[model samples]
Target: MVFTAKEFLQLRETLQIAVVKCSERCLYQSTKWAAELLNSLPPLSVADIASSQNTPGTYVHPAFAPNNDPIEAALEAKELGQYLLAKSFFDCKEFDRCAAVFLPESLLAGLLAPPNDASSPVPGDKGKATASSSSHEVTLPVLSQKSLFLALYAKVISGEKRKDEESEMIMGPQDLGTITNKQLLVVSRFLKRWFDERGSGAGESSASQGFLEYLYGMVLAKEKNDEEALSYLKESVQLFPWNWGAWLEMTNLISRVEQLNIVTPKLPQNIMSFIFHAHTAVNLYQQGQDLAMSINDLISVFPTSSFILTCKALLNYHSKDLMAAEQDFSNILALHPHRLDALDHYSNILYVLNLRPKLAFLAHLCSSIDKFRPESCVVIGNYYSLLSSHEKAVQYFRRALTLDRSCLSAWTLMGHEYVELKNTHAAIESYRRAVDVNRRDYRAWYGLGQTYEVLEMHAYALWYYKKAAGLRPWDGKMWQAVGSCLQKMGRDRDGIKALKRALLADSYYDTSASSFGSTGPVDRMTQMDPEVLLQIASMYDRLEEEDEAKAYMELCVAQEDGGAANAEAGVGGGGGTILGDSVAIHADSPGAGSDGEAGEGAERAVGNEGTGVTVATSKARMWLAKYSMRMEDYETATRLATELCQDGVEVEEAKALIREARSRMEPVNMMES
Candidate 1:
């Protein structure tokens, strides 16, 4: 088939789409096809077209008419062909070959030639670009901005790959961590030299400068020079807003919402800017209505985009709507089964829901598709974590980090696994690394708080918990941690205030009337967290605030009643028994009956497998008994204590309270007699 220039350009677009859809699968084949297509097209130069016009009976086609610059068309065709070939090599992981396609032979020869040698003039010298260097300049082909950027990027990747391979050969494929600055310095030096040669001449286009800036920014980012990287990336995006890679680099530099807000306005006002903002918002965990609006706008523009769908799924995930997030991810995968961007999050949902078989299937599928991918590793890690193989989970999480050092989920998940293994120090280190990568990740801050709390460092734990709470103000777990830490630090009033905030945050209360036309608000408060009420009541009791303590105790009792009613109505199962509760039991903790003290009665009660209602009722009665005794209401105290003894929870304490109440009542009875 004789392919015209326009036809070849169209084929290049098709191949690009195929590359993105299939990733590495078709890269080599596409590259070979592009090469063959390029070879089949007749080589036409300006000199040839000019010489053909002077030849006898030479026919010049209308496509190469005088109105059109045939040389420009020829150059365009050559640039596109080179770009397609280089991109294919890049996608196929032949970084050196990709770079060689763009780097001028003159520049490469100049680097190898001795500086003092008069044979090869320096490629970028301004004065040397006179008539004396015209021959060398003609030999160098003009490269497009994107082609140059890709070449530099390929060099960076090539350097990293070379270093990693060497390390792997020595260390036998263990986790080698992030690439060192020493390895990237080689690419950095070449980039600096290229820019120095280009200068601020009119010959350099704005697009060219933008690509160069983006490449330099990427190098600086990998070297951990955030300030410089941010400056370069910001400039690059402003100069060329369509480059998604530059926008992504900018996103990585922003670690906080404040920084994101500050940087957002500086971006160019265009569709890419909007997309960048939406992407950054998701990364920063800003799942507010504004983020939703931004996502909706992008979806309207690109309805079938898997990236937008992934963002939507992440928003739902952060909103605690696991089922909605799961469905969104499922839809995305159904449309684009080969996509590997957010499979880790889907695996997380499965792990939380305890869908062991499905998680296993996902892990196996991801491994089969590409085991080296970070998302696949994370999926496998979550599967191991679900199976209680925490050490294996950590190993895979570590491997994921090795693949992508800035993988936020791997660091945070590894910290969780470390915590499970009781490796507090290792967990702290992992959490700190995660925080260093992205301060907006509340999970890392929360993990840090939990680690410190386990170590009994209440002050440190409280600070970290507060940091997490500040980031995710609506997350009740963060507030609850803050409250617990404050209580441990003996700040009872502050602890109560924090606990109340947690209660408000956690409860999904419906103030509107029920569908059945109830006159009052429907008491549809899911996750009311009876433990928060108990904790607040205990604090109030310690403060000698009888009314407040009694109020919270009554609320706990009402909560249990509501739960029991739901169970009887078949709305949900009655909360599990104390022994079946997932929370660990401490002997000295309130409502935890001591086996040694209660003896055979506690054992029999535990064997009965009482519902959550029974546990809540027992706790409420125990507290009420103590409160009544404190108020000198001997009859009420005796009645409440007797009820606890019958329930068999805290049996020894209930019996002791009954004995004290009876002794006090006996004196009063003597007066009556």
Candidate 2:
């Protein structure tokens, strides 16, 4: 093997070409041959153009240069060679023999290596360690190859491999890639495991601490092999008490499976994971999806858990698997009836779906929670209301209000009870108290308005009604109230517009069976005024003159008193017989008949609600005659003129009455007939 420099150059060229081809098939494998060929080049330094031609996902092709431009990389290569040679023949310093030409340890490690055989020393081997001790007999300066391999392997096994080699190899610092924390951890751990496992000492392999297995589990989890991942994680935790990552990743993995509806048998080793699965199932059910599978999963995984059983019951309720949901709810109640969330949710479902009697069942539950959780009282109170059990509803609502004075809903519900019991004044007071607590409480405002309307306090009703409408514009019933109250108050245009909006917004009858509907109940409001007049007059006429007092004044008065004179005068003159009955019958009487209109032109003596324009005009004439006799005093004229003003007739006459009445204290003046 006496090779000339030209011969060395030719051999290196041939090896580099072979290495470039071999890199395609194997990276380290090709690098092994390339290093040997570069070793043959035998120069002070060669251009070790270690470029990697990478094509997208393919491996990088190797090139090299030991030139000055890459002196640092070249030095790292040299350091790597020196380290390897020292390991193989440490005491003899055999790597110095090859110092004129060599590669760094890391670069050489990255260099493709030939396949291991019986001849190549194992990457981590006890067999090569003593080769260093044997080399101590050799002389210094020129080193042997065997010495180099021994020293390098010692550095590798000890984790004392110089990091500066990697630093030096990167040029311009821009291409300096860092070993990420995770990667460094892997390398350090891998080396430690290898050295410890392969130590010459026989008992070194036995130990309880085993991070490697946990790392392997992480590998399985990353690969998404759930069963294998769980297996490795279990083994890791069993072998090592402090491998927190393994336990955490396993719990997280199990939790996620439970999320995807994948059921599993409970893991006896992991109580937290078992409970987490049940919780996950419950959450999914609440999201509007069918959670029957989740319930079944919980049942299978945690058959005896109270939390699991409780959730199953709720799922059953939603599925109308009523028996199951009820069973679950009952089980929960039996164990812990004071669970506010469970009790409230169960009661609400019952209330919304119109399940009444169950409220009493809830009432039983309420007593249990009331001592510890007073909010449950409200839940129980609602149960009583659901049954139209107004007395009990009132009882519970008042109890809840006592516990939570700021409970606007409790106050509102109490008011509703009053309304059901026909205690309008009491209802109004409760609603007003509720509104005082929450001025924005739309329900309270609405309830107050309804109570006032029933009590015939139109002005008060209108104010509360508008507040309710403003708070909840989407509540068509509120808008409908606005329309209805406005109509009654003679604000016709605004009322009609509000009513139309109510109709449009409340178009869907299924949701709100209110003022707007697809059915014939639509005409109810149009008939209100007539219906009211009829009922009122009937009650009044029953007592004759007393009927007027009952309806209009609510009490009898002396004739000299303000109300008594007006009642006796029969504003619609039937000789002091105001008919005190229906408006229709008043017209049939002399109020607007031929005799009433023509005879003495006395139709002017009709009541405020009597008949036609003809009757009204005739009454005005009589009033005119009275005006003349009274010497400019004109109560009769004013009354008749007011009627004429309302009918859109003789606008001038109506205006004159108002002006003349303002000018003189006596009633509106008439011409001296």
Candidate 3:
């Protein structure tokens, strides 16, 4: 295929679009084709095209002219061609071929040579040339530095693949851990030599040094030397802020908000830094106006970027705004259907919403695209989980972990499935592994609490629940778990405190979407979980706070009634609650009430058994009747007991309460007579 200059420009624009959209497959195919095209072009044509394009960091020698010097033009063409080919190979996962293109034979030989051999040639000297007529030495092209970084990265990845192969042969398929220093020693030594030579006033530019720094930091990070890796990554970002790769490396090293706050001021205040902050904040689940502002700013700068949209979707997911997250991810997939990143999250949203058809379709689509991907496996697992196929879900989740041991969602979801299957021990192990991979994962900690609670270990459950609550202070579920554990441990006052926090958290989350300008069809009032109120009321009753307990029980009944009325009036549908309005709660469903609301506390019962909201409400009425009798309000007590009997909930208890109330009323009547 032949391309005019205009066509070449169009191709470059296409590549840029692919990159901004985060379409790796598109970028890979384009680069591969472009490399082949450049290789077929004549030396002069290649030189003319390369010089004409405004590629950043591309250096053209002042003394060289394509029209005047055929030799110089050929050398430039060869350099550019090699770099393009290596990048294509890297994108295609042909890491060995990619590295071999940029790394000289001597360096490749030294990779296998003894570590003590000081006779190995430095990597930076590969493309250096001495001009025959001039005293000035020609430095390697700026692309050479990028080529070197790519070569080192390729080698590291190749080594990992070799390790995986060896591990499979030795121990069968299992979780492959982090890359060791021994495996990365070759690349580490090469980068050290490059930096040493550059530090000694070698002709390498700051940009070249930054690339080398990023490579070294990446190697160190893989080798689990995070402290040293962080320093190199920070320097790499400072030296070359345009290298988004380095910014990503820096983001990976800082997991905590405290660490991020300390590092933010030190980074260059540029577009890349803003992006880094936003990305890291999302991963850390640090929600605030600043994260929102950063995402909006990035959207303005890259309006067509699916990557930015994905980030926004992630923020919504972390904030528990399932409706907004669903919309954002839907928009992203509409624009770039081939995107595989975050599909696991999208599937999760569908599962929570009970959009079974959509979740199933997504799983089928992802499977068709690439079934081996961890994300795809997670999606499939969610699909099976939604169908109540716990074993099938576990199988797929295991496959996902086998593909990538650090897959946070895989571990967490597998734990959930194990819990569903009553395999509490397996669930604990999965959750533990998830926390080991990423301590910031509240879901894993929450799962651990649930598992311990199942085993009736209130002390251990409280500890794990507190850890989860600390990570997600605004998550009502975590706070509720903590409160439940405390109450079980006979700590009534502390349980009350935790339950109050849970109520506050729930209120904040229920209204959070409106604050974020979400015009989704959610009715914030109807989104309130009646179970939280019930739990608080029950706790107060246990504490002997008659007035407080009665007030809370009345509040729970009122809210449940209001929610039911709203549902009947069609005031909300497909919005507000995490389950959305579309999913009807069937009476036979283990955890749902007659009013179509799942009782959150009841749903947490062991063996998938649940006490419906109707039953809970009746119990509240029964207690209220008893309270009225004790307070000498016989008429009120009799009325409440009769209502409970009519409702047919707690019939035996209601009837007994009625007889007691009537007997007490007879004594009061006789006294009045």
lDDT (tens digit, per residue) of candidate 3 on 1-673: 2456665554444434324322222223333323433332223456655765567376553223242334434444667778778778877889888878877546555444543343444455543222221222223323345456667777877887776554431112453343333448888867776666667887623434365787799898877799999998899878755455667777777767899999999988865577788888888876666677778766754555767788898887676666677889998888778768789989877776667788888999899999999999999988887778878888998888778777888888888887878888777888888887777787888888888988999899899999988888877677788988888888988887887777666555545544333554335444334566567778888898877788667655555444433233221112232211212111111112222233233222111122334655776777788888888898999899888888888888888988887887887789999
TM-score of each: 0.70, 0.28, 0.74
Quote the positional error of residue 333 for candidate 3 in Å. Answer: 2.2
Model 3 residue runs over 4 Å out of place are 1-144, 168-181, 193-197, 200-209, 288-290, 520-528, 563-613
Tens-digit lDDT track for model 1 on 1-673?
1445555444434434333322222224333433332333345566644554556476654333331334434544668788789888988889888888877545656553334454444678667646444433322236555566677677777887876554432112453344354436656766666665667453533324366787789898888889988998898777655456677788888878889889888878765677788888887766555677778765654566777778888776665545556678888888778878779988876666456787898899899899999999999998887777888988899899778767888888888888888988778888887887777778888888888988999999999999988987756667778988999999999999888777555432122112112233433433245676678888888898888788667666555434332222221112321111112111111111112222222222112222245575579779888989989999999998887887789999999999999999998999999
lDDT leaderboard ranking? 3, 1, 2
Candidate 2 vs candidate 3: the TM-score winner is 3
For candidate 1, list the clashing residue pairs, or say none.
none
Quote the positional error of residue 513 for candidate 1 in Å.
Answer: 18
| Evaluation by lDDT, superior candidate among 1 and 2 | 1
10 residues in a row with least lDDT, candidate 3: 582-591
Model 3 residue 4 distance off true place after TM-score fit, in angstroms? 30
CA RMSD, predictions in order:
11.9, 32.9, 10.3
**Candidate 1 global TM-score:** 0.70
